[model samples]
Target: MKMEDYTVEFCPWCCEEVVIHAVGITACPSCGKPLAPCSVCWDAHGGCREPCPYGCAGAEADEQKPVTTPPITQEEIDFVMANY
Candidate 1:
Protein backbone atom coordinates (compact mmCIF):
# COMPACT_ATOMS: atom_id res chain seq x y z
CA MET A 1 0.00 0.00 0.00
CA LYS A 2 1.10 3.57 -0.70
CA MET A 3 1.69 5.86 2.30
CA GLU A 4 0.51 8.82 0.27
CA ASP A 5 -2.93 7.23 -0.06
CA TYR A 6 -3.38 7.27 3.74
CA THR A 7 -1.76 10.60 4.58
CA VAL A 8 -3.47 12.90 7.10
CA GLU A 9 -3.14 16.62 7.76
CA PHE A 10 -3.18 18.25 11.19
CA CYS A 11 -3.59 21.88 12.23
CA PRO A 12 -0.38 23.41 13.52
CA TRP A 13 -2.21 25.99 15.61
CA CYS A 14 -4.97 23.97 17.33
CA CYS A 15 -3.57 20.52 16.51
CA GLU A 16 -6.89 19.43 15.06
CA GLU A 17 -7.10 16.77 12.38
CA VAL A 18 -8.18 17.64 8.86
CA VAL A 19 -10.81 15.29 7.41
CA ILE A 20 -10.48 16.20 3.78
CA HIS A 21 -8.16 14.35 1.39
CA ALA A 22 -6.00 16.86 -0.40
CA VAL A 23 -2.49 18.28 -0.51
CA GLY A 24 -0.96 21.77 -0.77
CA ILE A 25 -3.43 23.09 1.81
CA THR A 26 -2.83 26.62 3.07
CA ALA A 27 -5.20 26.39 6.04
CA CYS A 28 -6.74 23.69 8.22
CA PRO A 29 -10.32 22.97 7.21
CA SER A 30 -11.28 21.94 10.79
CA CYS A 31 -10.07 24.97 12.75
CA GLY A 32 -9.31 27.42 9.93
CA LYS A 33 -5.81 27.64 11.38
CA PRO A 34 -3.15 28.84 8.96
CA LEU A 35 -0.76 26.05 8.03
CA ALA A 36 2.95 26.68 7.81
CA PRO A 37 5.02 25.62 4.82
CA CYS A 38 7.15 22.63 5.76
CA SER A 39 10.77 23.57 5.29
CA VAL A 40 12.14 20.04 4.92
CA CYS A 41 9.33 18.41 2.96
CA TRP A 42 6.48 19.20 0.55
CA ASP A 43 3.92 16.62 1.67
CA ALA A 44 0.76 17.57 3.63
CA HIS A 45 2.38 16.66 6.94
CA GLY A 46 6.03 17.05 6.04
CA GLY A 47 7.69 13.59 6.46
CA CYS A 48 6.04 12.42 9.70
CA ARG A 49 2.46 12.45 8.46
CA GLU A 50 1.29 11.51 11.92
CA PRO A 51 -1.74 12.80 13.84
CA CYS A 52 -1.14 15.70 16.23
CA PRO A 53 -0.03 14.74 19.71
CA TYR A 54 -2.23 17.49 21.21
CA GLY A 55 -5.37 15.65 19.98
CA CYS A 56 -7.90 18.47 19.65
CA ALA A 57 -10.77 16.02 18.86
CA GLY A 58 -12.33 18.68 16.64
CA ALA A 59 -11.42 22.34 16.43
CA GLU A 60 -14.68 23.21 14.73
CA ALA A 61 -16.51 22.46 18.01
CA ASP A 62 -14.32 24.99 19.80
CA GLU A 63 -14.84 27.63 17.10
CA GLN A 64 -18.61 27.33 17.09
CA LYS A 65 -19.02 27.22 20.88
CA PRO A 66 -20.50 30.14 22.81
CA VAL A 67 -19.24 31.68 26.00
CA THR A 68 -20.33 29.91 29.22
CA THR A 69 -20.59 30.91 32.85
CA PRO A 70 -17.40 31.84 34.63
CA PRO A 71 -16.17 29.78 37.56
CA ILE A 72 -16.32 31.07 41.13
CA THR A 73 -13.10 32.53 42.47
CA GLN A 74 -11.51 32.53 45.95
CA GLU A 75 -12.14 36.25 46.28
CA GLU A 76 -15.86 35.73 45.90
CA ILE A 77 -15.96 33.09 48.64
CA ASP A 78 -13.82 35.20 51.02
CA PHE A 79 -15.97 38.26 50.47
CA VAL A 80 -19.16 36.37 51.22
CA MET A 81 -17.73 34.93 54.47
CA ALA A 82 -16.35 38.29 55.60
CA ASN A 83 -19.62 40.11 54.88
CA TYR A 84 -21.71 37.48 56.64
Candidate 2:
Protein backbone atom coordinates (compact mmCIF):
# COMPACT_ATOMS: atom_id res chain seq x y z
CA MET A 1 0.00 0.00 0.00
CA LYS A 2 0.96 3.61 -0.49
CA MET A 3 2.00 5.91 2.34
CA GLU A 4 -1.38 7.70 2.24
CA ASP A 5 -3.19 4.43 2.90
CA TYR A 6 -1.62 4.06 6.35
CA THR A 7 -3.17 5.56 9.46
CA VAL A 8 -1.53 8.27 11.50
CA GLU A 9 -0.29 6.71 14.72
CA PHE A 10 1.46 8.06 17.79
CA CYS A 11 5.10 7.33 18.43
CA PRO A 12 5.34 4.88 21.34
CA TRP A 13 8.74 6.24 22.32
CA CYS A 14 8.12 10.01 22.18
CA CYS A 15 4.30 10.07 22.31
CA GLU A 16 4.32 12.35 19.31
CA GLU A 17 1.60 12.09 16.66
CA VAL A 18 3.02 10.85 13.39
CA VAL A 19 2.23 8.70 10.36
CA ILE A 20 3.85 5.29 10.07
CA HIS A 21 3.02 2.73 7.47
CA ALA A 22 1.46 -0.55 8.57
CA VAL A 23 4.42 -2.43 7.07
CA GLY A 24 8.13 -1.67 7.46
CA ILE A 25 9.65 1.02 9.68
CA THR A 26 9.20 4.76 9.55
CA ALA A 27 10.61 7.59 11.58
CA CYS A 28 8.37 9.87 13.55
CA PRO A 29 8.13 13.33 12.08
CA SER A 30 8.26 15.06 15.45
CA CYS A 31 10.85 13.08 17.46
CA GLY A 32 12.59 11.11 14.71
CA LYS A 33 11.84 7.83 16.49
CA PRO A 34 11.64 4.76 14.29
CA LEU A 35 8.89 2.15 14.66
CA ALA A 36 7.08 -0.61 12.85
CA PRO A 37 3.37 -1.28 13.37
CA CYS A 38 4.07 -4.72 14.71
CA SER A 39 6.49 -3.26 17.28
CA VAL A 40 3.57 -2.63 19.61
CA CYS A 41 0.20 -4.29 19.81
CA TRP A 42 -3.07 -2.48 20.44
CA ASP A 43 -5.14 -4.59 22.79
CA ALA A 44 -8.93 -4.76 22.95
CA HIS A 45 -8.79 -2.62 26.11
CA GLY A 46 -7.25 0.15 24.05
CA GLY A 47 -3.89 -0.29 25.71
CA CYS A 48 -0.57 -1.08 24.11
CA ARG A 49 0.89 -4.56 24.51
CA GLU A 50 4.25 -5.98 23.59
CA PRO A 51 4.29 -9.15 21.49
CA CYS A 52 0.85 -9.11 19.98
CA PRO A 53 -1.40 -12.06 20.71
CA TYR A 54 -2.64 -12.08 17.15
CA GLY A 55 0.89 -12.92 16.02
CA CYS A 56 1.64 -9.96 13.87
CA ALA A 57 4.51 -10.42 11.47
CA GLY A 58 7.95 -9.66 12.86
CA ALA A 59 6.61 -9.17 16.37
CA GLU A 60 9.00 -11.75 17.81
CA ALA A 61 11.95 -10.47 15.81
CA ASP A 62 11.20 -6.90 16.79
CA GLU A 63 11.31 -7.89 20.45
CA GLN A 64 14.82 -9.23 19.96
CA LYS A 65 16.06 -6.03 18.32
CA PRO A 66 17.53 -3.22 20.37
CA VAL A 67 15.92 0.19 20.43
CA THR A 68 18.23 2.54 18.58
CA THR A 69 17.61 5.48 16.34
CA PRO A 70 18.82 5.03 12.77
CA PRO A 71 21.26 7.63 11.47
CA ILE A 72 19.52 10.47 9.68
CA THR A 73 20.61 11.22 6.15
CA GLN A 74 21.22 14.66 4.65
CA GLU A 75 18.04 14.38 2.56
CA GLU A 76 15.94 13.82 5.67
CA ILE A 77 17.60 16.75 7.45
CA ASP A 78 16.98 18.99 4.49
CA PHE A 79 13.37 17.91 4.24
CA VAL A 80 12.73 18.63 7.91
CA MET A 81 14.56 21.94 7.78
CA ALA A 82 12.73 23.00 4.66
CA ASN A 83 9.33 22.00 5.91
CA TYR A 84 9.56 22.90 9.58
Candidate 3:
Protein backbone atom coordinates (compact mmCIF):
# COMPACT_ATOMS: atom_id res chain seq x y z
CA MET A 1 0.00 0.00 0.00
CA LYS A 2 1.08 3.55 -0.59
CA MET A 3 2.26 5.69 2.31
CA GLU A 4 -0.54 8.15 1.65
CA ASP A 5 -3.09 5.41 2.14
CA TYR A 6 -1.90 4.75 5.66
CA THR A 7 -4.11 6.51 8.18
CA VAL A 8 -3.34 4.62 11.39
CA GLU A 9 0.28 4.72 12.49
CA PHE A 10 2.52 3.35 15.15
CA CYS A 11 4.36 5.99 17.12
CA PRO A 12 8.06 5.23 17.33
CA TRP A 13 8.60 7.20 20.49
CA CYS A 14 5.61 5.95 22.45
CA CYS A 15 5.19 2.68 20.52
CA GLU A 16 1.48 3.27 20.35
CA GLU A 17 -0.66 2.96 17.25
CA VAL A 18 -2.39 6.21 16.51
CA VAL A 19 -5.21 7.01 14.11
CA ILE A 20 -4.18 10.17 12.32
CA HIS A 21 -6.76 12.01 10.23
CA ALA A 22 -5.46 15.56 10.26
CA VAL A 23 -2.62 16.84 8.15
CA GLY A 24 -1.52 19.57 10.55
CA ILE A 25 -0.43 17.21 13.33
CA THR A 26 3.04 15.79 12.82
CA ALA A 27 3.96 14.49 16.23
CA CYS A 28 2.74 11.37 17.91
CA PRO A 29 -0.60 11.93 19.58
CA SER A 30 0.48 9.72 22.47
CA CYS A 31 4.08 10.69 23.37
CA GLY A 32 4.55 13.60 20.97
CA LYS A 33 8.00 12.36 19.90
CA PRO A 34 7.14 8.81 18.84
CA LEU A 35 6.58 9.77 15.24
CA ALA A 36 9.49 12.12 14.81
CA PRO A 37 11.16 11.67 11.42
CA CYS A 38 14.89 11.87 10.97
CA SER A 39 15.65 14.97 8.90
CA VAL A 40 18.79 13.40 7.48
CA CYS A 41 17.28 10.07 6.39
CA TRP A 42 13.87 11.00 5.04
CA ASP A 43 13.49 10.23 1.35
CA ALA A 44 10.79 10.12 -1.38
CA HIS A 45 9.78 6.66 -0.15
CA GLY A 46 7.41 8.22 2.38
CA GLY A 47 9.42 6.80 5.31
CA CYS A 48 12.87 6.65 6.79
CA ARG A 49 15.51 4.71 4.92
CA GLU A 50 18.24 2.44 6.25
CA PRO A 51 21.01 3.76 8.49
CA CYS A 52 18.64 6.29 9.93
CA PRO A 53 20.47 8.70 12.20
CA TYR A 54 17.62 8.65 14.66
CA GLY A 55 18.09 4.86 14.93
CA CYS A 56 14.64 4.14 13.51
CA ALA A 57 13.45 4.73 17.04
CA GLY A 58 9.98 3.23 16.77
CA ALA A 59 10.23 1.32 13.55
CA GLU A 60 12.54 -1.62 13.95
CA ALA A 61 15.88 -2.66 15.36
CA ASP A 62 18.76 -2.79 12.91
CA GLU A 63 22.51 -2.47 12.95
CA GLN A 64 23.49 1.15 12.52
CA LYS A 65 25.76 2.04 9.60
CA PRO A 66 28.09 4.92 8.92
CA VAL A 67 27.17 7.86 6.73
CA THR A 68 29.54 8.42 3.86
CA THR A 69 30.01 11.52 1.69
CA PRO A 70 32.35 12.36 -1.13
CA PRO A 71 35.56 13.94 0.07
CA ILE A 72 36.44 17.38 -1.27
CA THR A 73 40.14 18.11 -1.57
CA GLN A 74 41.99 21.38 -2.03
CA GLU A 75 43.24 20.20 -5.42
CA GLU A 76 39.67 19.71 -6.63
CA ILE A 77 38.69 23.14 -5.39
CA ASP A 78 41.69 24.74 -7.08
CA PHE A 79 40.89 23.01 -10.38
CA VAL A 80 37.31 24.29 -10.23
CA MET A 81 38.50 27.81 -9.49
CA ALA A 82 40.92 27.73 -12.42
CA ASN A 83 38.17 26.69 -14.82
CA TYR A 84 35.36 28.89 -13.52
Candidate 4:
Protein backbone atom coordinates (compact mmCIF):
# COMPACT_ATOMS: atom_id res chain seq x y z
CA MET A 1 0.00 0.00 0.00
CA LYS A 2 1.05 3.59 -0.48
CA MET A 3 2.57 5.44 2.46
CA GLU A 4 -0.48 7.66 2.73
CA ASP A 5 -2.78 4.64 2.96
CA TYR A 6 -1.69 3.74 6.48
CA THR A 7 -0.83 5.20 9.85
CA VAL A 8 1.59 4.17 12.55
CA GLU A 9 0.25 3.96 16.08
CA PHE A 10 1.46 2.66 19.38
CA CYS A 11 -0.44 -0.39 20.57
CA PRO A 12 -0.99 -0.05 24.30
CA TRP A 13 -2.01 -3.66 24.77
CA CYS A 14 1.12 -4.98 23.12
CA CYS A 15 3.29 -2.08 24.22
CA GLU A 16 4.68 -1.81 20.70
CA GLU A 17 4.28 0.34 17.65
CA VAL A 18 2.15 -1.00 14.78
CA VAL A 19 1.13 -0.04 11.29
CA ILE A 20 -2.58 0.46 10.80
CA HIS A 21 -4.01 0.48 7.31
CA ALA A 22 -6.82 2.85 6.52
CA VAL A 23 -8.77 0.35 4.47
CA GLY A 24 -9.29 -2.52 6.88
CA ILE A 25 -9.15 -3.76 10.47
CA THR A 26 -5.48 -3.56 11.27
CA ALA A 27 -4.58 -5.76 14.21
CA CYS A 28 -1.43 -5.58 16.22
CA PRO A 29 1.01 -8.18 14.95
CA SER A 30 2.31 -8.85 18.44
CA CYS A 31 -0.80 -9.00 20.66
CA GLY A 32 -3.68 -9.21 18.17
CA LYS A 33 -5.28 -6.01 19.44
CA PRO A 34 -7.18 -4.30 16.66
CA LEU A 35 -5.70 -0.92 15.80
CA ALA A 36 -8.52 1.56 15.59
CA PRO A 37 -8.39 5.28 15.03
CA CYS A 38 -8.64 7.69 17.96
CA SER A 39 -10.18 11.14 17.88
CA VAL A 40 -6.87 12.75 16.97
CA CYS A 41 -6.27 10.43 14.04
CA TRP A 42 -9.88 10.54 12.96
CA ASP A 43 -9.82 14.31 12.85
CA ALA A 44 -6.45 14.29 11.16
CA HIS A 45 -7.82 12.15 8.35
CA GLY A 46 -11.08 14.08 8.18
CA GLY A 47 -12.74 10.75 8.96
CA CYS A 48 -11.95 7.29 7.67
CA ARG A 49 -12.76 6.19 4.13
CA GLU A 50 -14.82 3.25 5.41
CA PRO A 51 -16.74 2.46 8.57
CA CYS A 52 -14.27 1.63 11.28
CA PRO A 53 -14.39 -1.98 12.46
CA TYR A 54 -14.13 -0.85 16.07
CA GLY A 55 -17.10 1.50 15.80
CA CYS A 56 -15.10 4.60 16.58
CA ALA A 57 -17.03 6.80 14.12
CA GLY A 58 -18.17 9.02 16.99
CA ALA A 59 -14.76 9.24 18.63
CA GLU A 60 -14.34 12.71 17.22
CA ALA A 61 -17.07 13.85 19.59
CA ASP A 62 -14.96 12.88 22.60
CA GLU A 63 -13.50 16.36 22.58
CA GLN A 64 -16.74 17.56 24.07
CA LYS A 65 -17.09 17.80 27.82
CA PRO A 66 -17.75 14.48 29.46
CA VAL A 67 -20.99 13.84 31.29
CA THR A 68 -20.35 13.78 35.02
CA THR A 69 -22.41 13.45 38.14
CA PRO A 70 -22.43 16.17 40.76
CA PRO A 71 -20.21 15.60 43.75
CA ILE A 72 -21.85 13.75 46.63
CA THR A 73 -22.32 15.72 49.82
CA GLN A 74 -20.75 14.52 53.07
CA GLU A 75 -24.22 14.06 54.58
CA GLU A 76 -25.19 11.69 51.74
CA ILE A 77 -22.09 9.59 52.36
CA ASP A 78 -22.77 9.46 56.11
CA PHE A 79 -26.37 8.38 55.55
CA VAL A 80 -25.29 5.53 53.29
CA MET A 81 -22.61 4.36 55.70
CA ALA A 82 -24.98 4.43 58.65
CA ASN A 83 -27.64 2.43 56.76
CA TYR A 84 -25.10 -0.15 55.65
| Best-performing candidate as measured by TM-score | 4
Better of 1 and 3 by lDDT: 3
Model 1 segments beyond 4 Å from truth?
Answer: 1-6, 36-84
Better of 1 and 3 by TM-score: 3
What is each predicted model's overall lDDT from 0 to 1? Answer: 0.38, 0.50, 0.41, 0.48
Better of 3 and 4 by lDDT: 4
Supply candidate 1's per-residue lDDT for 38: 33
* Per-residue accuracy of model 2 over 10-62 as CA lDDT, tens digit each: 56568765554444555665666556554334667776565554343434444
Model 4 segments beyond 4 Å from truth? Answer: 44-53, 57-84
Candidate with the larger lDDT of 1 and 4: 4
Model 3 agreement with the true structure over 16-50: per-residue lDDT tens digits: 66543222234444554433224323678867776
Worst 10 residues of 2 by lDDT: 63-72
Question: Per-residue lDDT tens digits of candidate 1, residues 10-79?
Answer: 5555676433222232444445544432332344744533453222234554333332223223454344
Q: List the candidates ranked by TM-score, beginning with the highest.
A: 4, 2, 3, 1
| Candidate 4 structure, TM-score to reference | 0.44
What TM-score does candidate 1 get on C-alpha atoms? 0.29
Ranking by lDDT: 2, 4, 3, 1
> What is the lDDT, from 0 to 100, of the residue 33 in candidate 1?
49
* TM agreement with the true structure for every prediction: 0.29, 0.40, 0.30, 0.44
